[model samples]
Target: MTRDLLSPAHTGCLQDFSSRYTRTCRLDAEQVQSLLYVLGTTLKANLNRSAPPKTKYFSVKCTDNVQYIISPLPQASSYLSPVRLKDNSVLLITMKEASTQENDNKLSVWYYAANKKVLDKAILHLTAVDISLDVDADRDGFVEKNNPNKNAWKWGPRGHGAVVLVNCDSETLYRRKPDYKRERILKSSDVKDMSPMVLRTKGPPKLPEGYKLVLHISQSDGENIRVFITSGERYPLVLNSEVLSKEIPYLGTDEIMFYVEGVSFPDKDFDGLVHINLSLLEPIGEGIPETPIFTDTVVFRVAPWIMTPNTLEPVEVFVCSTKDNYKFLSSMQSLVDRCGYKLNICYEYMNRGDRWMQDELEFGYIDSPHHSFPVVLDSPRNGKLDDFPYDVLLGPDFGYVTRVPSRKDVSSLDSFGNLEVSPPVTVNGKHYPLGRIIIGVAFPTASKGRNMTKMVQNFLWAQTVQEPIALYSDWLEVGHVDEFMSFVPAKDRKGFRLLLASPDAGYKLFKNLQNDGHGDAMLFEEIPDQDSISVNEILDDKQLQAENNYVQSCIDWNRDVLKRELGLDDEDIIDLPILFKLLEYRGQYRAAAYYPDMVNLIVLGRNLGIPKPFGPQVNGVCALEQEMVSLMGNLGLTCTFIDDFASYHKLLGEVHCGSNVRRAPFDFKWWNIEM
Candidate 1:
């Protein structure tokens, strides 16, 4: 009866055989012999081998009284295929149903050699017992369960169950047959004992938000163990692992540690798990090694920060205007109207007698024409001028909301009112007040001996409070943080996201324009001042190349410092394509021409005000302005373009320097919160 059951039947496809053999079929001597002959012939044909088999073949009857036979088909079999273990050992794999006598109907994998002999077998331990393996059991064309759109199947252990091959000499088997290569499996005893353990460090059960959490791994017996960390939550947690080594000269042994830094969670009450995976690799031979994996998880809750940007409210905005800025102001008013007239706009007139106005100098340093004007926060209102407070002076330039004003107080003053100023401190060859942070540009003209003391003093005075200052490249004439980056409230009302000018995107657009033969024409048409000069004369190819390099380096440095200070990731950044022009400024040197100023935008609540693109029109619309508006719309922001090409861009200023925001006062007191 067994021989008759095991006899070869003409199945049209391999799927028929896989579906039919759900139960074990006991084989007789004649059936086993016939299977072995067929397997040897198939192996020889597939391997292109002409030599006769030298090894003996045999069958093994499992404890459940089910006889197992390994054989190869004339064609490639989807149900039965050869797989190489990690140790470079080849095994013929097949799925067999659990015995009727056993209560558990678990998956059982049988391993055999090409010579039709059973080497080893084991029952897989499955945590997810509900997994269905009826389809793609061989994993030839299996699509990932998580990703349905993917066409190619991911190659690995596909099912939910885990298998542990027992009583197999992986090294000797690979040595005998050098052609075989496959993924390796661990022993059943080792697999059962594998469980990752987390070592404790100095910290409470709940960690404060934006604080770093250092974790140490307990010493284990294995020499070649690799650990990996991953967060299962949406909160951004940075992970850094120390190099694992067995040689420590000081301790004379291996020491390993993993550092996990917790950032400000998007939500205040975030509690989640961090998973750690440990893999122990064992070398089988000169080929690949076998690994046994263990997983462990840690629970942590993040405490909210003292104060965040969420408490901010809308307030009055300030802009400087002169007789030359009427057109620009008109355009700005139009934009404000388009934004539903939500913003409270105020104007400060510039002093016409200021000597700096005659030449292209630092217009930012010019005082307001009105003596009693509230230019710097917390300044004296008596019209008699003294040195401005360091914090208040720094606050306006950097646009930092240092302190909130009281409703009763007529003048907007900070907490440190009428306090005597302290002397600046010099650290690492740079002069700065104690706990004061200020960002500035490093000009190439500043000498080591001279040290640009006045510029440094001005920067120190402008800082509203002690904060971590991030310095960016200042190769451009009007180089400022506002030129390249802007912080806007997130649409989710959680925090702020940085909007950056992407040089990579701009370069690609410019290259496309150059290829289309409009590069020279566009430059000449945009810069109408240089009517006699050709595009080649206006733009030096060498300088343009150097400017791009500097821009990229500056962007990289700013990104790194911002990530550290603001706890921001790449996903939190919004990049816009804004290119710069290398134009000859004065008769001696070349400077960056920042015309579009898309990133140098004004934020009025949820709406953003930007400068119109300063260039030729493409199909009745400015190309750069259209791109900027489209990008802003994609980010869920309402964009209004203000034409400032003649009044502001020509003077090497943009919407940011021309205007400032006096944001709404929040209830949070800076003095009450810990820095």
Candidate 2:
């Protein structure tokens, strides 16, 4: 719509009534610049008398749907009277309503000087067209027309904007590949995993000649997301179709749909909010390209992958069955069967004998109001079982995502065993509904120390919902966070305990045994295949004691960091009796667990799978196992010990390293969390 320029009160007409002119225009209901605006400016210029034009004024007369705007609005507020016009000013007009039929509305304007009044008169025959582009901007299943909040996103129940899911899941089990890896849709079922966007138009059942609609995304968005359109005939938007940005002709239909799929997850460089634009392009002719007359935009945010904490219910547990792990597998089977959760066993053929299940991948899920699915994060630490996550886990409703780094950048720190998530906690007033992520890295000053690659770290940090915190683990030979600490659910307080391995506790336990005439008692006494050492010999080794002291200092450093980051007090933590032995490597020494690392245990609701630390017998029972039971009993947890000594303990990994769990997603939707 154009503003009606009114002239100063005039006494007489300057031009003859014979100066009448008429024109026709096609006006878009949502156009930013109206057709009448051009008509008004051209009408004044053609008068051919600039000096006399300094005295021209104009007024408009039209129906309720037509509005004429005037600057320094006329005091009379009535178009019946002439309003003054300033030099170098423009005459503008606008259509307020979408006409039901062609030329169903009319508008008229008169130009006058003083009271010579009418200098020139123009009549416009108008055809109004309506264009509405939409998406599930409110996150509801159905698309609503041009929502006011579509252009932006907000929070809370009143917030709006569509939620997009990263199409990382593999729909085809036969030839496995992530659905988003392809530029075009491969299966109809894949469509269900993406968000829907639509373009709707109505007016005269056809658009004006040379006018068209176009859908486009920003260059940055092209790398993160893709949009697909569906056409009924001729050129059906199908396989190998391009979706970056293209002209979409008016098909004389009321609606056209486009599906938005996230091809990449959020990262440090991307905040996850993406915009898709629809424009109505008008042909300017003379071999020139069309210009957009009106643009409608909607925003979408890629849903972050959320990590489930141990506090959540477990649905399934995954572990590999190698020839040497029969006893470990038997113990795991008993524990899982008793807990009533499903257990998946990867046989030698699938695993190829590699059994570090937890190091190969981490389990998490991405969610939206429209859909949700579990996504396995594959690690860069490619082991013999590297194919397990993609081959067996990437099925319908299941997804697989990974980050690859140069092999030189990969180390033991790159393993998923270094990855863990804490239970929900409130630090100050902020709450982490899904808890925060925990990963191992080198101490800041260790120039040559091993650390998780930046690619994986950025991906984890980009998740946003579970902000990740790095803990120093390079002091340990394996460089995995799980080797020294883990979380277990509790019935009270913070709802979980931060179990840490403590060498101090280990020495205290050994001293008590030596004082009770158990100095002759030996460690690993039951295992005939291994050498045993008496408790007195361990107490007398000053070198071993010094090594443990150094290990304690390292564990202490991380304990303080976790306390401050997780908002924990001493009572929120549990110190387990565990020891470490130092190994020399290239003129430097690193600590490794001397016994099965008991802190590296799997939590399954009330039941726990702990490594059986085979310490010397105390009154016909393993004193180390009894100590664990006594400490865990106060929290009402049942500790079931699994013997992984010969199989995994000697290999420097523990039960948690050999097993993985897929827990149920939180009942609380992630969208509600404060970002």
The Cα local distance difference test for each model comes to 0.35, 0.79
| Lowest lDDT 10-residue stretch of candidate 2 | 38-47
Per-residue lDDT of 1-675 in model 1, one digit per residue for the tens? Answer: 111112122222233233211322122212121111110011111111211233222222223212222343222332243332222121122223322221222223444456656554434221110111111112222312212211122212342211111111122222221010112222222111111222322112221222222222323211112222322322121222234321111111122222222221112122111222232222334555432221112321111111112113434444445656777677666766665544333322323311111011111111111110112322222211211222222221221111222333312111111111111223344432222232334444534211112322333333222343534434445445556676666555224567777766666655555566645535325544644322333244666656766676667677776655554567777777665655555642324444556776777767777877654354555556677777667667677777777677776656755665444333322122232
TM-score of each: 0.39, 0.89
- What's the lDDT for candidate 2? 0.79
Best by lDDT: 2
Q: In candidate 2, what are the lDDT values of residues 223-302, reduced to their tens digit?
A: 78877776542213321224567777565437787788887889989989998887777788879998876677789989
Off by over 4 Å in 1: 1-312, 340-350, 353-375, 378-438, 441-466, 492-494, 513-542, 581-591
Model 2 bad stretches (over 4 Å): 1-55, 77-79, 88-96, 155-158, 232-243, 251-253
Task: Give the number of the best model, judged by TM-score.
Answer: 2
